[model samples]
Target: MPDSKLRLPPEAVKKQHSLVWRIILYFALSSITLSVIVGMVLATWNYHRQTEAFQSRLDYIEAGYTESLGSSLWFYDETQIHTQVKGIMNLEDISYVRVTDNLNLDIETGTRPHHQDIKTIELVYKNKPLGNLQVAFDRQAVLTEASQTAIMMIIAQLASLLLLTSLLVFVVHRLITSRIRDMALEVNERIDSNSSEALSIPESAVHDEIDILIHAFNTLSEKMNNELKQKTRAQQQLKQVNSELEDRVEERTQSLQTTIDELNHALKALNKTQGKLIEAEKLSALGGMVAGISHEINTPLGLCITIHSYIDDHYQQLKSGFDSGQITKQDFSDFVAIMDESLGIMDKNLQRAAHLIKSFKQVSEDQTGEHIRDFSVKDYLNEILETLSPKFKKTRHQVHIDCSEHMRMSTYPGAISQVMTNLLMNSLIHGFENKEQGNINILIAEEKGNAVIRYSDDGKGLNEEAKQKIFDPFYTTKRGQGGTGLGMHLVYNIVNQRLQGDITIEKDCGCEGACFRLIIPKKLDVSDS
Candidate 1:
């Protein structure tokens, strides 16, 4: 399409008169018209003014001549009249002076120039009119002076008009016409496809509408160029993206398949490991119960053995006294008393050992078995504490179970027992490392159909690293000192995998020890195991 800027061709521009020339012509005509009007008005006014001045001069001459001429006419002196006329004729701007007698005789002096304005006054003596004095004024001298003035004025006005028109033409050509020509050339160049670079124009500090137009066109050019570049880049990018997308989709599909295979293998391994974990969990818990029970049983059994040894010695002394015939009634009485005391001590210690064994047996049975039964949560917590009592008895650490006795759960009691055992042991071993006096609190409550257990201790809280890996298998702070690390891991597994519950280490726990929050379902799904 042809650009609007090039709508007017060079030949057309030349054919069309430039605005500057037209304006100059119009200005010249207007100036000439105004000058002519002003010149005519000034000439008319000058004519009238000169006429008045001339009239005054004529009146003065008439007045002066009246006295002399009246005297001349009254005495009938024609020579004096002639002399006076000649005198009037010698005055400036006076072309001809004429004198006429009452007899109708006329006399004149000086030559008549081109035109004349004549005035007549009668000579009167003693109130009687004498011959009339006709004074004629020559307009030729005034016309000559006025003609000189008009010539000068025309010259000056013409010069000024010429200079102004020239300046106007020069300025208009440079500022407007030339710039328009440049715009046309630029548009023509742009229409040529080979010169399709973006248009650029030099800008002036001060600008007019044409400059604004140029700026707008430049902006459009820049925008089109940029859009074209962007279009090319976008097309390339789209192609690249399409190619890459196909490759990525293929790679990702292969990767996903591999990941699925790896995941299946991992899941199988995890299942196998889970079975071993269950067994290990059971053996570990049973071992702890056995150790605690044995510890407790040792004391009572030792006492019983001591009592038996004493009773046997006393019996031997009695037998010896009887054989040697050196025994007394007091010795027999002492022997009977010792025997009674020994029997009573033996019975009490045996009963104590049996009780310890029974408690261990019950705890072991519950922890190793995943049997679901209705059990009081509070009472279960107490039982686990009792079974683990030997571990804490030597320390000044206090463990409090804060749970409503009425709070019961129809879930796996074994899981509950094992979880509590692990948490207590974790606190004792990891939390209260060397501290004798510590406090452990277990708060159990029901919330939204789940038993919320908050267990914390007043011992050194877990560090950042420990908190992060606390539930990871074989990750223990006290690895060599029989930490085992499985306590918390086993607890996590039981609570999450078996008990169908969730547990979180609450960092904001208002205690100086690690706090574990366990949310166990009141009713567990036994099939999950």
Candidate 2:
């Protein structure tokens, strides 16, 4: 089965390049296509003009041969004419000139087969027509000249094409591609090193298509620079305004802080007085209840003692009689049974009395106070913390103890124990309720003959409002959750009144969350002069 909680979306990454590459490709393709078409048309026209001129040359040579042959004739026989024409036929453009007679078929030519072309014309004298002059042009020679001319024409065409192509490619590549590449490289290098300089196009370049384009690009760049300067001006103004705004914000913050501090101090004084009043009230109530409970337990206890004493006297009398052989074995057993019943009643009542006394003593001590003891603060604090092991384990709380090694001071163990226990319980119950983990820190030291103990936690701490009143007696946030509201008050009483020390709490620094500080003197009411 596919996991329902698996992520099915793409994470953010750089996008692939598409736009700029297409532009470069389109520009190069268009240039090449335009160049090829123009080149082909010019080459075709050159080929046609060269071919027509060669054909005209051939026609002029043929006409000159006919007129010269018709000028005169030694005889009206073909044999003499052929002999005369062959003697004067050794020229370049006229490959061969031949006159052949229609009458004599023998020895009628000037090496007839050798001189290939023949212009046939009638030899006439004074209105008398002679035999025809037939001249032959060499088929092999004419075709060879035509082939060379064709080759030269093709070479000329190719040369022109090569020159034009090279020029176009270089102009487009250098005037366009190379220049652009240089500009791009310059821009890229500047950007890499964080330099802000405009790219300048090279001069000595004429007005080609790319030259016009470069001019446009340069104009745009200048316009952009101007706009950028305007933007920079606006940005500076915004920065100044922001700085002023920040100063105002800071002033307001300090004012708010002062107001908050005063409220905290007032609330603290109120809570201290309130705690004292409430603690006195709870103490009075507890004292009265303790007295009543003691009285109630003593009545039943006294009755059991009276009943046991009376029964003991009877048993003693019976035992004395039995030992003297003045009583029966049945009488002895009955007396022993009665004594056992009396002892049982007495033992049960005594146990009940002992329980009442222990509960009363514990409540009285916590409400009133505990005896002070001179002991090492480190040892005392450790004992209290260990006694809080149950609370720590239950709430999965972590504790850190940082104390000066080999430093010892005199303090009350019971007071510290009660104070530490109260704070730890408060943190575990309220601070780490829904948290994954929690921390409690215990620090001990001596400063100028005064012992100091500090305890804190990484759990959720008191809010701004709650921090002020959290130490107040009977002012509990855990009302429905079995909070007695007397825990911190009791702790305060134990620390300040009983132990003769002062306490201070540190609040949040506005970082990740709240931080609590507990600063206490190694000794109470000590001031540095």
Best by TM-score: 1
lDDT of 2 at 51: 48
TM per candidate = 0.48, 0.30
- Candidate achieving the largest lDDT: 1
Each candidate: what lDDT?
0.80, 0.59
lDDT of 2 by residue, 425-473 (tens): 6777777778868777776766767666666677667776677876676
Q: Write down the TM-score for model 2.
A: 0.30
Query: How big is the RMSD of model 1?
Result: 25.7
Displacement of residue 61 (Cα, Å) in model 2 is: 99
Tell me the spans in candidate 2 whose CA falls farther than 4 Å from its real position. 1-369, 508-516, 519-529
